[model samples]
Target: MTILYMLLSSLEITDISEQELELIEPLESKFPIDKIKVTVCCQSSFICFRFYVLSSRYKWMTYKEAATARTAIGCGLIHHGILKGSCIALYFINRPEWLIVDHACAVYSLISVPLYDTLGPDAVKYIINHADLKAVFCMPLTLNSLLSILSEIPSLRLIVVVGGMENEVPLLPSSTSVQVVTYSQLLSQGRSNLHPFCQPKPDDVATVCYTSGTTGTPKGVVLTHGNLIANASGFTISVKFNLSDVYISNLPLAHIFERFDHISLAHFGVAVGFYQGDTMKLIDDFADKETPSKGVFCKSNFKHVCRAEYI
Candidate 1:
């Protein structure tokens, strides 16, 4: 017999236990935990793409800053009449803004739907129409793709470009009634008129992740708040994480695995650094010697894996 079957046979258990099927409490309950003094860790924790800003140095947002931003963004959405349970699309590569918007969704009980680059234009169009998304948060690199498909998605009302200046955005056709705004503009409006948080229950839907459509048409999978919490809790138990640990997030956040990784690591106050949007330079980011901090504590070269070290 195979080693896996042999191991299973050695176990005395016949059926899965009740505890195994039970869901854990939401992580939001532990908001601003005493031990998690700082959420995103250091100033150089979240590095932006070199193309966006000519600086080689990185920047970060502390948990407090992140929480404030998320609250503002959530209020901004509400100000725009995007009520709770409304579906918002996240169409961009991994970045700090992505996480900020995601947290906004969780806090305000809005549903987040991720769009993957690997899904191409056709699949993306399909997913947008299928989900009936009204607003999409994108970056300069992904804006063109989204704009290209705008005429086809009538339900789309607003386009918030993250990390992009107003002038950089291409002029939309006069016929299209869709509005486009910068991320800063949204935050500004939100700060002016804040809205109360519309917290979600554990059974509420958190996200609807679409598949790659490799088989044919892309299919969206619904995930609840309880589902994410349970998965993140299980991950926390499997690995011993330290508060000083830093996780390098290089995987696409559109995928559930990467999403879970972010949630799990952040639960323990682990600092997460996003890749510089260039896979080739990822190694350089890991071995970056010019960081304002001292020498690196450790290194791991695995793909889509977190490298724990002190910076």
Candidate 2:
């Protein structure tokens, strides 16, 4: 029976070797026959683990579970499923079109909406005021935009943004009644026991994205874990895979494309570096050898050095 389960588990996963698959198929077959027939679909949510937590020092931050150890994020994603060590991952692109098709293949529950990039404060306020938004996970810029109008919408309860900063921003009259947290901090705060990284469940509505409307009012799209996982798996298959490198994530993570590929790539053993806001200023230094530039200031005593003729 032990050998049978091993053989069965291998067959359920498509990426394994034929011999390995053959050896493990029977073992896995013992599982619910219905489960056996069910294909293991990686949805956008399952494809990547994008949320992060800041370290104790808070100078730098990584995924909620990363602690000091960096990872190839995709590798981390499938670590339970396949790989041995935790991997680092990063996200930059944010395209729902790419996320939708793949999302369909994995979990099949997709009610996704694109949070509008161009919507005004009024529109954002309206969405938060009316929509039954359970939670909001966003990047730094979007978070800022939302904060501006939070007072306008009293219905909003929680805001979960992605990155960390030296100081927490002042929300709701400099310091009123608005809960603010980064993705990493939220996980850390929410953890009940030793396990630091626990994502929201599959059935929970994952996101409430408001599309950027050019003509009509922006509409919110609701997404689930299944939808996200499907997007993630399809994205993993398209990239040129190699786990030893780092990916630059400049695009808005709120978009599924960045979130999916970033998480999927991590499973493949790639590390991700998230340069703040605009990536253009970052020195094009991905090579392991490039020394990070240290901030420096120069000061010289002008009169003493020049021997000023006074007197």
Candidate 3:
């Protein structure tokens, strides 16, 4: 029983390996110096990782590709162009910057509906029915409260759950009337089928963002890719951000505020320090004690304190 329990508990990945753990166990009379390892507590947990700029694997990309493809697509939702269709409805718990860009460029020309994460099921149902959303591109939802509302959202034709397969959400319904896809699948279709130069243009209507009116029904706001590019670029040039800055992230990506900064950072090749929850919390914990070695706070919590060379 003890062995089984130990094995089960051992699955948690510490950023440090057995080799580093050994060095850590013996209290060295010496101070924590070059490559010193320690744990830091962060927004909802503890995380661990050695401090270094070039050690991580995730790479920063450039701007030229930003206009060609969806700014960011997950593992399953990859198909583009004709497959994406037009006059679609995008339901996001977060801001849909990429969708708007596509809409602006005449790529997807989607109508976006924003769902409030804190609302009860009843409110969600009301918005879906009222919006006449034809297709929804969204991150996976917990408790399937989203799926329950689907039956009531008549205009909904497709559901796109972004990212990979190991997600906790349940398998989408077996019904053929409404289909579910992952983000990568959409990108795959585009990569394999679309003409390399045939991507959405810069001047088209990128997306329709519906405002959540507290007193009345929601109103849709038309936005273009040009708008997002201009907005994101303003931050990029003014913020002095560079390709090497790393930011620790955890904010819902479905808002324009996040998109504004994401475009700036992505264009510059900023290394994003994504936490696997607690495992990545250590980096921030360490950042708190020392001078910020280019600290990036929660998605919304961040702001430009200095331009590119702030660190």
Candidate 4:
């Protein structure tokens, strides 16, 4: 059967065998699937997101905690009627909750479709309608933009707001049929009603990333679990990463480059830090006086760097 399957493909690699292909697994292969707490037994925090309102502060989560959150969020998604294999949209800036929700989708075999704010409302509406997203996990800033187009997205049933709602939930149109819930509320519901994990095959679609629409209407690029793992593997071969290394996630998560970077870095158990939403303060974040630096910076197209003292 494997020989026949390989022969049917357009390209053939005589050196590679069917057994090698079968060995390919999802991101969980590097990370673990079961015993989430024990597998990522790192006591130190693995992910942190900064908040700068009046002062600078960071919210940290250990790998164990992140794994737990992902599981709960995945179960919560199921409880909210977002079945496995459904397409969910992630509309937000770079943040910890974004990764949490994305990891949840990965664990449950749901296809995550990322929506960038720079894409504008028209493009966002087009992608939402085009992908037929079942649900959207967005921050409070992007909530209004999504709500404005609620009438257009027929497939969207749930709106899981990441941050707590600062103001009262906006009154929805009488004709709309969407339910809004806070991130914490969803987590609580999921905790009470835990669902079994639905593992995905290598060939299963992991995400459907959209083009920037600079030339024309955005087009969705379907990527499978195998494709992602392969991309990460290739990246690691080119760039070495260490478990003690820290990665600052200032790039937009919606971009495929940044997405692949995150996957590869996480595979190496590298800690990740998210900058405050404001781009103007990005330099300030790098020059944080409270945190010491090792004076080593890796220059990249995206300016990937980390403060060694953060770890």
Could you report the Cα RMSD, in angstroms, for every candidate shown? 11.6, 15.1, 17.1, 10.1
Candidate 3 is scored at a TM of 0.51
Cα misplacement distance, residue 172 of candidate 1 (Å): 4.3
lDDT of each: 0.66, 0.36, 0.40, 0.67
Please provide, for model 1 over 1-311, each residue's C-alpha lDDT reduced to its tens digit, 9 standing for 90 to 100. Answer: 11111111122233433332121123323332222222323222322222213444333355545556776898888888888888999987766678878888887788899988566888888888999888999877778888888889988888899877878877777899777888999999887777666656667788999887889999999998777766765666667666556777777899999998877765555567665556787777767554432111111121122233433
Question: Relative to the unseen true structure, what is the C-alpha lDDT of residue 101 in candidate 4, on a scale of 0 to 100?
Answer: 86
Superposed Cα deviation of residue 19, candidate 3 (Å):
44
Put down candidate 3 lDDT per residue, 83-131, tens digits, no spaces.
Answer: 3324443444333233323222232233334454455566556666665
List the candidates ranked by lDDT, beginning with the highest: 4, 1, 3, 2
Q: How many backbone clashes does candidate 4 have?
A: 0
User: What is the TM-score of each predicted model, taking all chains together?
Assistant: 0.76, 0.46, 0.51, 0.78
Query: Which model scores highest in TM-score?
Result: 4
Better of 1 and 2 by lDDT: 1
Best by lDDT: 4
Which TM-score value belongs to model 4? Answer: 0.78
Worst 10 residues of 4 by lDDT: 1-10
* Residue 234 accuracy (lDDT) in model 1: 65
